[model samples]
Target: MDGTWLDHSRWPSAGRVLAAVSIMPALALAGWLLAGLPLLLLGWFRPLPMLLFGGALAVALCVYGARLEREDDAADATVWHVAATCGIAAASAVFNGIFHSEQLVIRRDPATYAQYAVWLADHGSLPIPYGTAAFGGPDPALVPSSVGVYDYGGAIVPQFMPGAPIVQAIGHWLGGVSGLLLVPPVLGGLAVLTVAGVVARLVGARWAPLAALAFAVALPVLYTSRTTFSEIPSLILIFGGIALALDTRARPRAAALAGLVFGLAVLVRIDGLRDVLPVLAYAGLLIALRRRQGRGERYARMGLPLLGGLAVGVGLGFLAAYSLARPYLSYLSDSVLPLLAICAVVLAATVAGAVLGPRIIPAGWKAMRGGRAARWLPGLAAGLVVLVTLGLAARPWVQTVHRVAKAEGDVLNAKFIVMTQLANGLPPDPSRLYYENSLYWVIWYVGVPVVVLATLAAAVLARRMALGRGFVWLLPLAIIGWTTVTTLWRPAITPDHPFASRRLVPVIVPGLILLAVWGLRWMWARARQAGYGPRVQRSLLAAGGALVLLPAVVTSIGTAFSPIERGESAQVAKLCEALPRDASVLIVERVTGERFTQVVRGMCRLPVAQVRPSGEAGAAAGANADINLAAPADVTRLAGRIRSAGRSPVVLAAQQAQLAPYGPATQVVKLRTRQDERSLVDPPNGTWSLTIDVWMAVPPTS
Candidate 1:
């Protein structure tokens, strides 16, 4: 080896690690081919251990890569990071498969997004049952079910910003829902790498790789990046926009790219728009400042390229959203509000600029030199703008939220209670392994420590040195503002709020890591100033290491124990396997459950079809048709539906244990795992009652 090559001894080799990450996608595809295609061909069979084993192997590869560095060549770090991210991303996909799926059979909100992707890709719009289906089969699709338009059955599916869904749809067109599920992480990984590149450019080489690793392993990003969620996509746009703006040299193409990304980011999460408002305002102020300096043409030149980029991104976003939403225009009132408000704000800002251009330039100049007040004035203005925009956007959203809250009262309460406790400093419950529960507590418990430390470091750095002072603070401030607003406004408990910890995934994770790095560097500089002894420095390093690693260690343990339980899919698959396929079943749960049933029917071609509750339910129960009870009331109604059918169809009860009537007739099939799930049946009794309480499922009568 040449002398220039970095050492490569202790581990298998860089080539091996890089190969490990690249090989994951191939392994995942193989699993799908083996498990998924086989199930599709051979009447549905359980593929649990196969899926889990594949996922576990992928995760192991990622974790192994995280620790190994056979070679120390700085240039090779990017390859390693990419490999780790890709490998981890594939692992996450496998894990998601073990838990929830997008098909109607799995029937959950996360799966609902997947189903929606399939529907859109196939039909260019949401499925009819999505809007028209009622909560539980006993109810018509048009009935006022609590699950709302997006709920699959268990968790509330997030309303993805246009970019993510469109991209997901494209993936679906290629390889179905599984393909769509893979897209978010891929895009997210690319974004993370881009941010690392930006950091390498801005900060010195010493901190960038560490910062990149920190972001990659961040619990919030890891969890969300594992799913087909929108937060990561929005983050990509926001960071890409910032990177575009920070290029310093006025390249129109770069500015245009920045604008395009900003436009796309806003479409993914409107909150992202709020986060970047200050950046956009800064861009304007920069232009105005340049003009005042007698660089009017140069200012226009800078503005034009960015504007062009914005146009391209927004145009694409609108086309995507319009295509997806065309069939459900009635759903528009809330969806379009943000876009309208944005238009209004741009117009108003343009007018204000025209009116105050001369006066504001001087004030802006004063604010630039202005002390503490001036230092914060820009942020304050941006905050006010965001608040105002939210208010305007709220008009169409209020009714939708109220409906979702009332319908999903239990889930809403649970989400709210958990989120509130997390924000207030309560430890997470290991038993509650739902995505919302794990994410909410994890964000508060893990995120707060990282953010607080990073914020303090940036504050110190800004004060102590003049080099890249405000610029260094810009990304952190945008992140803080966005994180703060999201934590407060889009609380886990909020009705219609997509309940995933992944929503917090952002470029800020790396930014914070860099801040922590700066803090260490700062302490060392101070140690030198004080003429501290070697022992003192060692002690400081030890203390710092403890502070950083303690919570991380705790969180890692928590994550291991708190694997998410996608109850709906697991239960449904169990039901289908145990029940007779030819039997007609009236499956009922919450509104979310009803949606799940419909989706499963679409995917699995199940004989169950949810119809509006009729007085004749008692009559239909006895006719060899299965009466599957999912919700609370379904228990009392189950026996009647059976008696009405004339013959006892096997009954499946969810949640409740007691089988009071037709005692000998009831045969129970309970789900045995760490998860708390049970199903009781009425075997011999001709007409029996069954309560359906699992996440999502459609059963046959055996």
Candidate 2:
């Protein structure tokens, strides 16, 4: 094999070792996405088939990867580095496991994702059934859908893409709810390992552990990993794709696999489509310029496979979106159309360039690449990065970001922002987006030092790439820099801590930290070249690592030790068990229906519906609730209809008194848990006490 970047044997030992650890989990996730969707369509998504099909696909990938070889291959691994990476992976799992959140309540996205997985694990189907037969028929007062699940043509469809829940369903299949909760943490561990793998490949082997530790201890990593957030899995795929692409320098077959992994990120999170645009451009450029990937291997082996694999992965995502998640896709049409247009433009331009560049003055391309202007580009690009960052940092002082609510969720988000403002003692401003302070969000977690170092590293990478160097840093720099600036500029989520922070978890935070660690290493090497004493060099390195680790750890420390949404799973279990067998449950109160319609239907595996809000709950207990509820006459008619249909009718409510109008209320679920803090102006501090109660009654059939 040519001794180029593609030859894995030449990479530092830690890269090879970390690669082995990081690759499997990512591939496993991709395999699930590949295999699970079709089976879901067929209503055959049981554990045994999923295990057999998805597992076989993953094994095939590993076997194919194992065949990569070279005549000059040298030992490319060290036992200790392998041990450290494995240890990092294990520690992340254990830490997240110990602090795992039980977010089963249907309040936010995490709970929504959890419920989605719960349905998949239990039923192995899409477009959840309304089970309206038990209620005699559908009534206007009784709707099939609730929060996080949409009702289209009387079918209960879940919100968001199916990728995260599929992984979580596997966890549930293995060990029930406990296993499902464990999935995110395990993915988190895998993500930590993958981040280390990237650092080993791009930075240096010695910096791998520090990178792993820094990323592992950060707030977003812990927060996302402790719950069923899509970001962790997306993180795994993004970095894992990069690692595979780097391996393609030796194993040409791995190029398609890398594309598959990168493309699957769209399935995990829709925003991932935006995150991977650079790779698409880069691959196109490689083919357009006829760059050598290996000895005698050019002409789009990497480009074609990368694009093909991406199409398959992205095609599956779109298929699922149009078929199973149409409501979710429709809800996102405003953003989705523009994103698709951008992707089309990028793809068209890439094709145009590849077709035209060779035919239209090929030698001129080289001249420009090697020209005097190219020599000066590094400095100019580096300065631009610096200037842009400084400008963004100063942006909040001069301008405040605002957006009008365009949808139902956006309206709620605006109210949430107003509520948070009052909590923080600020004047009401519903349209305030808080995006201008996105740079400060970085500083709040990683501190000024890591951000500074990350900037330095980014500048250096741009400079080196300008001079036709820094191949290793190119993709990392592009993906990270592009995603960082774009996300911070328009986070596009509710501007509350822990909620808005999820935007930073997958790419922005970890990528910046990885770059900062690499920057620290560059400085150390420069110091040695400057003839500094070993002690001085060591001191500088230690301080830099501390700056990287300490602030992040301190920022996350309080929330790290305290897991929120405790006792939720147990409460769900109790509520499900307490319902009478063959019961057609109907919720009278609004909050109860919104929070438990999906939970009761999915987790309890029972037929459930909610009556519209009465608008007569004048007491404080029900006064603050949202959602539409029905009058007592309407609820009574629905229950009577259920009774006449040969089903026992039960009424559910948040308070015992809310059920008093129908029958004697029995408290089924009494839960007290801790909730993540919702800080708007400041960083998240700690958890808040959260209490929920569920009451049930079997209405008299007379």
Candidate 3:
């Protein structure tokens, strides 16, 4: 790499900057109004087609806007970055709105989100519900016994975090489902932006923006932003925590901040706690290890700030738990308090190890140093023995893994396999492989290569550190890797492997920044060594960052353009919106409109009617009696029920072709999709399709 290339020329001229800034605002305005304004217009009059047009035009405008006026001034480039990032996030949100009603059933753990949203709407200020089993409390008549009271309603539940839920709750209160749909991604976007800022500050200027750009374009981040999931927010806390840890100056304050961020991470997903353990444990270990060299006071001085942070963090955790899992906070002492106690014990142990290393462990020290297994056995056993002494130390984990595996297996065997057998056993779709395939592509495209270069950069930087300090500097990496490997092997890990990137994010994020800083210094040194021009070195470094980011950016954009099932809940939304406010709701399918509607209502605050059906409405029996009801019937039977009621009850029909038994009156509403648009693509053939059909009869007054 040419050394002179690394140095940037003076800012491309003020005229260029002014022109760039001017063009950006216009591009931004166009992008912002493209979908938003039309949707607003649709609300006033021409809704359906306007919404469709707005969406199509918005996508086009955004694609156009991103390409206009390309120059890379850090400040101006940052503006473009902000615009492009926002545009993609908004596009995902719009897609969410259009397709929300299609799924009929909540995907993944969105049910938990629904439960919390409903709790928030019913109560004021979050995570403050009574009893267990989500909104409306536990039903003794329905369940033999409460399996275990979980305060999923409060702060501890990631979905109901202070920032995310408060926003969604407002949305739920103001506009209902529409508000909820918009809320998650906005929070995700903010978190993403915050993470980007932290990343840029930690890494060199060149790498920071590019790293942020890669994340902005990444599919997983985009997907997380669009859905009511906590992954992105967890990402924010993890990165923030790591960045704080890397700051050498203000050690105590940084540690405290890191603790607070890690605490928030735990609130997002109980599993998220695993991500921060390496940093926290390693910091303590380092302090303890250094204590024998008469650095105990210095380590204590550094660790004191974190003590305040720990208190604040635990308080925040308790607050989060109380807010999200309010109904079950009392019982949280079992699940949460123990972990707090254990962490405290570890902190104390670290302090003790630091203060009394030689005196307290003289016997073990001799044995460990001598490699005498028998003499060292008690210390090792003592550590294990202490761990085991904690009540239910290992059983809870075993039980949880067993329960999840068994539940998933039974469902797959019974519902998937047996049902397929009854239906002539359809072959599995190949297209489904694309999900994991996309992930693999991204890992290779971005993660591995970045990691390799980063390691090289780290090695170069390590040469700058004095010998002892160099090894100590690398300690964080070892600790982080060990924690990551342990976490990945956990049985309950996310099935999405590339999501492992998110798991390693705390390390990767700060690590990259540190790498860039090192790489910059290394480039300077290399330039000096080769006697190359500073300008060339700077340019090469900048180019190096581009090399790392471009493939990721290109791959992500390419993946986004791939044909996917559009509007995951499109038909479901239509069904709900089409239904009269008074129409009784019935979901005959296992987890159809009834569950979706509950989530929708919980999310949106719409007063829908729930009703009981004529036959066994097994799956949706617990839906609201008037609007959230599930009516199980044949097409004719359903028609007869509608006729007998002498009014249309809102019906959501899935696999509408099966209702051929009913006469022509069983009209299914469908959007006329335009196939002529070259840019627009449909899901490739052989993909399993789920479509929702919303049906309503003509009002008598009309």
Pick the lDDT winner.
2
> What TM-score against the true fold does each predicted structure earn?
0.59, 0.94, 0.57
Ten-residue region with minimum lDDT total, candidate 2: 68-77
Instruction: List, residue by residue over 81-173, the lDDT tens digit for candidate 2.
Output: 667767987999999999999999899999999999999999999889888889998787787788999989778899999888888898899
C-alpha local distance difference test of each model: 0.44, 0.83, 0.41
Q: Write the per-residue lDDT of candidate 3 for residues 447-539, one digit (tens) a residue.
A: 544544555655443432322234434434443444433433332323232233344343334344345444555556677799878788778
* lDDT, residue 2, model 3: 66
In model 2, what are the clashing residue pairs, if there are any?
6-249, 6-250, 612-629, 612-630, 613-628, 613-629, 613-630
Over 1-702, each residue of candidate 1 has an lDDT whose tens digit, in order, gives 665445545445443344333223322322222232223223232234334643454355345423332232223445455455445444544443343322233323445455544544554433234322112234322222222234344222224443454445556655665566566556546555545544443443344454455565555555555455666666655654554454423343446645655665555554445555544444454455445555434434455466556556555545534543332233444534764686668646854664466578677657666567656654555456345334533433442222222333445555654564464355533223232232234334345445445555655544433322345345345554555444434333222112343444654454555566566656766897899998998798666645544554454433432334333344545655655554344434333345444444434334343333433453455564333333324433543454354433333223333222313323322333222111011001011122234322222232
Q: Arrange candidates by lDDT, descending.
A: 2, 1, 3
The lDDT, on a scale of 0 to 1, for candidate 1 is 0.44
**TM-score for predicted model 1 compared with the true structure:** 0.59
Q: Model 1, residue 383: what's the lDDT?
A: 51
